[model samples]
Each structure stands twice: as C-alpha cells, then as structure tokens.
Target: MNYMDEHILSLKNKLNYDVASNNVNTSLSQTVISEQDHSVSEKNLALRLGDELIPLELRVILDGEIEVSVPKSFSLMPLEQAKFKYPSEHRPEVIYTSEDGTVNITFNRTESTLANEELPEFVEQMADVLRSVQPIRNWLGTQVIVNHSGLSIGLIRFIAAGVDKNLYNEILLFTHAGQVMMGTFNCMESDMEAWLPVAENTVHSLHAVSLPLQSSLEKGADSL
Candidate 1:
C-alpha cells in the first residue's frame, strides 16, 4: 500500500501540534524512521586519508521511506551555496529550526494532493530524496567520500557497502536545511549513488594503526 499521502500529512500534523512547552520547546515526534519492509545497517569504518577517528553509521531504508532529525550545528549555506526558500514551483520542507540553535530535517511526499497518475512521479521524487543521501561504494578499495550541504547541520555521514538486499538499498543523513542542502558521494555504482558530508576520517583512521617491532627484526608495521 502507498501511504505517501497519509504519511506526508501525518508528518505535517506531528510537526504543527507536537511540541512541549516549558520555557524550552522541543518538538516530539518520530523523526528519523525508516519505512516498513526494509532493513537498516550501520557500521563504523576508518578512513584512509585523515588522522581523525570518524564514526560512520550506514542505514539502508528499504521499501524506501526515511525521516531524520537534525542537529543545531547544521544550516543552509546561504544564497550562494544553500537556498532556504521553500519550493514555490518545486521545493522541499523546512521541518524544524530554533532561535536557540536547534534544527530538524524532514522529507516525504508533497502534501499538495497527488493525482492518481502521479504515483510514479511521487515515488521518483521520494527516491530522489533518498538517493540524495546514498553512500559511495568503492569495491576495489576500502574508502568512500561524502559531502553534506545542509543548513547549520552537524551531519555525521554513514558508509555501508557489500550488503545483502535484505539489509539495505538506501541510506539517510540528517541536516538542518531539510532538502535544501546537497551532498555528494565518491564511489561508483551502476545502480547506486552516494550522498552527504564527505567522510574525511574513515580511511585515514584505518591507515593509522601501527604494528609493534619484533625483537630480532626491529621493524614495525602500520595499518593502511
């Protein structure tokens, strides 16, 4: 069943009415959730190019639907790099933002009432949103790159490759600008593409492990 309409509407409702008031208003709802009939897998991979230890979590949202909440540090990059304007002709939602430095990203089908014949387009739009965050997979190597461009979004990219179909086919990353920001992947795929803040620490971290020297050999080996 296609719950696109219902899903989108429900999401809007949740955002409009579900806020706690106490001097601090924190929106409450199920943000960052995957659709049914899908599996999500996350892993921590070391980068081969940097000295920093990066935590990359891979989540595959199958049957494809994902909702993500954003961190306060992320935001739209302004007119030159990021556009915060809502889609007049075609735009994504600006789910959440706070003056106290809080942001949430949300994505789903448009609530403009999908025509009976618009299912294909609707699904494609949803897929495009999901595809925007897919990971770049390097089969022959042990590294991938991500570029996340959302508003004040302190994004943490995930890298997951070589998994059974039952595990994942799509990934999701969260930022403050919702769909306004852009992300890029570094690997190649015939049927796949990548998304989000270029992973700078994974491969570089894996290469930093050093091996101890032998008593006789007096040599040390390092991980790369």
Candidate 2:
C-alpha cells in the first residue's frame, strides 16, 4: 500500500472517525463540538492549526499524545531513535515526511523547570547543540508570541542554512505545560519557496492538549 493509504488506515484505527476511500480522493468527515457551545454542530468542520484552517479531509489522527496537522502529501510516522541521533535529552516524538523524503517536519519535546532555566537561555543552549551537529552557514532568530483559540504560546524561530548549500532548516522552540517543544523543518534549498509556508504553518499549530490518561502514565513510568 502507498504511504497515504497506510496513513489513512492508521488514522482509522486510532481515531475511529468516519472515513471514505476512493481511487481518486479519500476523505475524513466528523462533527465536532464548537468551543462556544456544548452542542455539536455539523458545520463545525475543519481543524484549527495555529492560525490556519485545515480541511477535515486533510487531517490525520490528532489526539492528546501529539497534535499536528497532516497535509495531504505528507505521511506521519513515529520517530525511530536508532535512525537519528541528537546530543540533548530532547528527543523526537513524531515526524512528517513527503513522499520523496526531500522535506521533513520533526516534533520533539523535553522537560524543563523554572528553577533550571528560562526560555531564552534554553533557546541559546538548543541552538548550540544544533550547530554542533552541522555547522550553520547563516542564521536568523525571531520571537513569536501568539494567543489563539484560548492558547497562548511564546516561540523562538531559528532560520539557518547548513554548510551544505543544498539544504535549509527552520527550527522553532517553545515551552508548553512544563515541556519544551521543538518543531524543525528541513528541505532542499531548491524547494524552500514551495515548502516553507507549509512548514511555518505546521510549527505555529503546536499547542498543549491532554494526552490519554494511560498514555501519560506510561510516559511518566518510562522516564522514571
């Protein structure tokens, strides 16, 4: 089966939503509760991804364990530690990749405390770690503070190109619910024009949501 088909099947099993498959187009549709009301609305369609609105049909399974939009052309997979190595305690939670593997979005999370450090300090430390892996050729840093859908987030954006002239990376760091989250977008330098907007939108979509009680407990246990 194709990656798209496999992703849809995984969503079906995970979310139990109404999904229809067709050779030409596959779609997922569901009625969700509006934030303003306790009543369910049929037209309350589309999932909110940061400031962007993604059609329901294009959304993959998003629950509390991890939340992010899955664009039609991308497939979501669990991070395999054996495949990628990083020096920090922060680890990749999930990854979204295009069919050709030329583009990738990685979601990572790490724990932090007020007593240990602040956001700016954490960003600098993380930046050093990233630079250590691959020397950065050019870098730009910015801060994003947004409050939307009752969620307020402060993020640090790092735009860097590595020594390899062919690749570019955009990494965002933020803290939510006592955990630091990083969203990294990497793509060919040639494809930046077409993929950068998508990557930014995905990064802005990060928010704090409750994971399944059992899943939360299991993660806590593993950390012990």
Candidate 3:
C-alpha cells in the first residue's frame, strides 16, 4: 500500500496537458472546517476565522480527472523554478506557487495501485513512513481518514525544516485511477496560523472525480 514509484517524467509531461478543457465551476469553503469535523463524527462544523478570505479557483488536474480549488493568486510553477525552489531530486507531479514562491500547493498521483476500500490502510502506512522519514520532526497533527464526496482522505501536518527556516506542511492523501494521489500545502512557519485555516477550507473544497468506478458500481447495482 506504499505510494509506489515516482513517475516524475511522465508527471511532468502531464503537467503540459491542457487542464482548462476539463474545468468545472466550484467554490472553496467560506469558513474553516472545524477540527472535530472528521470521520469520527458525522456532522462537520464550520468555524469562522477573522482573516481576510483569499480568492480561490476551481480546476482539474491529474490528466483532468481530479477537481479541486486552490488560491486564485497562485500560478503553476515554471519548470525551471520548480527545480530551483524544490531542488530536491524528487518532486511532486505538479506545483502551484504563490507570487513570491513562499506558499505552495502541490499535487502528485503515484503509480501505486489500490482499491477504494484499501485507502485508509495505505494512508496509515504512508503516515508511518512520514514519521520514519523525519524522526526528529515536530509533529503538528494527523486526522482520521475521512470520507468525502465518495473519496477517502487522510490528512497529516508537521513542521519540516526548510533551507533557512521552518515550514508548516500539511499533506492530504487519497486514491484515484487506482493510484494514490497526494495533495499538499506548505508555507513558512510564520504564516502557518493564517494559511492553515485556508488549507483546511481547501481540503473541504476538493472533489475527486469518481468516474473510474462508476461502471463497476452500476453493474453491481444492476445485479443487486
């Protein structure tokens, strides 16, 4: 249930694909999704954060199969800058960066094959890996896997050391097209208080396309 191999090359190619063709209308959550509003509870709470709302845009990604909302001011990271900013040998499938490049949201769908029901287990495994990867990292919090819009989402947050400063990172994992899909939000630790709420709102706004399972579900329903 690991996230499997990095398909960076193919992912980069996919980044060039015209996502605009698959665009859909959507809106981000107006208020922060309450911390207690997760799989453990059926009722989701929306708490108002006094921070000014950031404009958001809804767009499709991962070959136009996933629909989600991100800050409208963010732009796709240019290939050269992605290499420089990330500089890591491994990188996400695609990255959207703030105008100054300090804040970022990333998306990556790995080659790992999986079924919908197995998502929570895999996510737990992934969480274990995250802990192992940075043994001394400051742990923020992790969420119980949640069912949203027919998709299973696992969220984890931590503070990772950046080149010259600390960063607040939140990662959301799910499955699509039989693969594990990852979405992330990160910013300087100084901005965490303001952006973390927005990140939570963004999580609520995401709606993964479930077409791949439709045919099978329909067949089973017919048989029933």
**Cα lDDT listed for each candidate:** 0.26, 0.44, 0.60
* lDDT tens per residue, model 2, 178-223: 5555566666555555555455455544445556799889999999
Off by over 4 Å in 1: 1-49, 54-74, 84-89, 95-109, 112-224
TM-score-best of 1 and 2: 2
lDDT by residue for model 3 (121-167), tens? 65555555656554325887777454455567778777765555566
- By lDDT, the candidates rank as 3, 2, 1
Q: List the residue pairs that clash in candidate 3.
A: none
Give the Å shift of residue 8 in candidate 1.
15
Q: How high a TM-score does candidate 2 get?
A: 0.53
Compare the candidates by TM-score and give the number of the best one. Answer: 3
Error of 3 at 13 (Å): 20
- Candidate 2 residue runs with Cα over 4 Å from true position: 1-63, 78-91, 114-117, 128-133, 147-165, 210-224
| Candidate whose lDDT is highest | 3
Query: What TM-score, computed on C-alpha atoms, does each candidate reach?
Result: 0.22, 0.53, 0.67
